[model samples]
Target: MKEFTFELPTKIYFGTNMTEDVLQKESAQFAGNVLIVTSGRSLITYGYLPKLISIIEHLPGNEKVVVYDKITQNPKLKEAQEAISLGKKEHVQSVVGFGGGSSIDAAKAVAAGIASDENIETFLLNGREPDGNVLPIIAIPTTAGTGSELSKGAILSSPAHHIKAGIRGKKLLPRMAVIDTSYTWTVPERITCETGFDVLAHAVESYVAVKSNAFSEMFSEKAIRIVGENLPKLIRNPGDHAAREQMCFASMIMGSNLANIGTCLPHRIQYAIGACTESSHAAGLIALYPSWIRHEFEVNPRKLNHVFQWLGYDPVNDAAQAEQLFSELKTEWKIPYSLSELGIRESMIEDLADQVTGNLANDRLSEKESIIRSILKESYLFRQ
Candidate 1:
């Protein structure tokens, strides 16, 4: 049992009606105006945003709610800075993240930038550390993936630099996380598959990361089991609220687990892919995870076996069984099986490979460019 230190300061409100039941009460924790960071039109179209706004406006004080919906897929550093600038101008004292991982992460970055004079660009590229002076953030996860609600790392992309990195510190952790399964009930089937895979990636990668300890491993194991059992069900029947609830819990657990232990090759590589091709983060992971497991299974057979067993597969000699499992899941879930299908050109392989940092800190994996290139090649095309 390796030594570890852990603390989760975020207050979590789980189950149904959490948002409408406690949004104003929780928002009252911080005085002054509040900023709501949201992404895309899904939540807005679903009317979640208006309902949230109504709750905030009904608060006791003259607390104004400002909505910033400029967040995009693979959230950009400039966007976060823009949000921070808006928050500062509005005299915002707190933030509410009201959508998926991108929205929540952008909100956290905005929170961090509000606390410091250093811009978000400086923090992403120059290795600046946050001073824990961030405005309070309340995360409401509308998606059952990325686990951004419970995580302390806010992933941001700098398009000019073509880099996707995270600002990780205890300060980025949400002051409150509201997990309501009702928010995820309307997620489309394809998105369910994509984000569902992300949930599994966090569980598996964090469990096998070099920094993993007894506490994180326990959470990771449970998260993996929950996802393995429930994701497929939810994918098959989007109306399964019970399965959706389980997935929401698993996603939260994985988020907390990743915050503590970090992730391995698949996640590290997916960042590079997302930066290069602007592809879906979960899609890239789905394309690469099996190949990665096959490549590293021999180096850490015990860990791989544990994962396989938990997922109801038996890999006697290698990751063949694991690969087969995901392949079947991909076909059943109708997810694209190759990067090319996701619009990543094969010609950009070297560009993608060059961006790979292999900074997973895994003893079984190397950060070497040659090794990363090899993994990319294997993952470029789907093998039947």
Candidate 2:
């Protein structure tokens, strides 16, 4: 019912075998050499990176080239600093992020560091604003979640700070997004489902966010349908291109949805879970979602109920809806229903709750600690 405006500037290339051409299109925005940023060694093994290099090398007037494949899960400040040093040393004109969320996020951090005079560590910790122009970044996502390919946010871990924080701004958004579903073929079935849950969570958060608008809802609505219908199917049959394409399409739409509306409880909570427990972000979300949403259920049950509706269930109430969504996802993927089984502790609850609420400056975070603890308790007890 509230009015809002939205803007998404990244040019998206969707379909099979379009990753190469999308990079070429994005290349027009930059001149000279480019930094090739990647993660998980997938580029080197699956022949994805070599093929990309072939295309980039064929282009005329492309001179400077560097490869920074030192990215790791929960990409760190040291990595960004190294990347910046390499970027400055190489004087690259652009960066191509080739991999999943970590790689794309590292690409954003690399761009942020390359564009600025200050250290990115301070920015990532305390949420500093970018004041300089960033080099063009072309994102080619090999996974379907986190939406980092199109998001302006990057999360980095710093041992010095002993915390995980995010650097966010439109400047960090990729100049172009190459989201070819064909590339997702190499993704493991478990990751496909976990990341799929992240996309599903993205749409749900975007739909009910305080900043939601008509346009954001439109994107989320379709995204929820696409992901709800396709995620489990993809898990069942990871090679199905149609389902993969639908998941990719939904991922992008969810990106747009979050751009305008932003995310709240579940995403913020998942951040703490990942920072502390090192649980897979999406899987943590899958564990915490039912509990996290319960705190906000009375706020808008019907809106959240739509998630179940789209997932082919009738949610008679909050409990039923949560069970239906989680149960179905777990059943399809054979995912366990407990956080402890995934290596989370009950003792982490108090601290995690503190961080989840402390991390935000918004009014909603002012609730009593019990409410926060209760959420984590539910997450601990959640099972299909």
Q: Which prediction has the highest TM-score against the true structure?
A: 1
Residue-wise lDDT of candidate 1 within 1-384, one digit each (tens)?
A: 668986777899999767777766664664578899998598889899888888887877746889999899789988998999999899898998989999999999999888787777888886565875998899999989899998988888887898888787888899999999999999999889899889988988888788888998898889888877887788768899999999999999888886777788887777888886677789989898767877667577788788877877665575676666666767766785687776777888888877866455663566444767777887788875
For candidate 2, give the lDDT of residue 219.
85
Q: What TM-score does each of the candidates earn?
A: 0.95, 0.93
lDDT against the true structure, per candidate, is 0.82, 0.76
Using alpha carbons, what is the TM-score of model 2? 0.93
Q: Per-residue lDDT tens digits of candidate 2, residues 1-384?
A: 665778889988888887666656655654688888887486688988888777887666777568898888678789888989999998888988888888888898898789788888778877886668888888888888878877888877776665767888888888888888888888888788888888888988777776777888888888888887887787778788889888888888787766556787777766777776566667777887766666556666777677668867777575556555665566666565566665778887788777763233221432545665776787786555
For model 2 the local lDDT of residue 142 reads 88
Give residue 384's lDDT in candidate 2 (0 to 100): 56
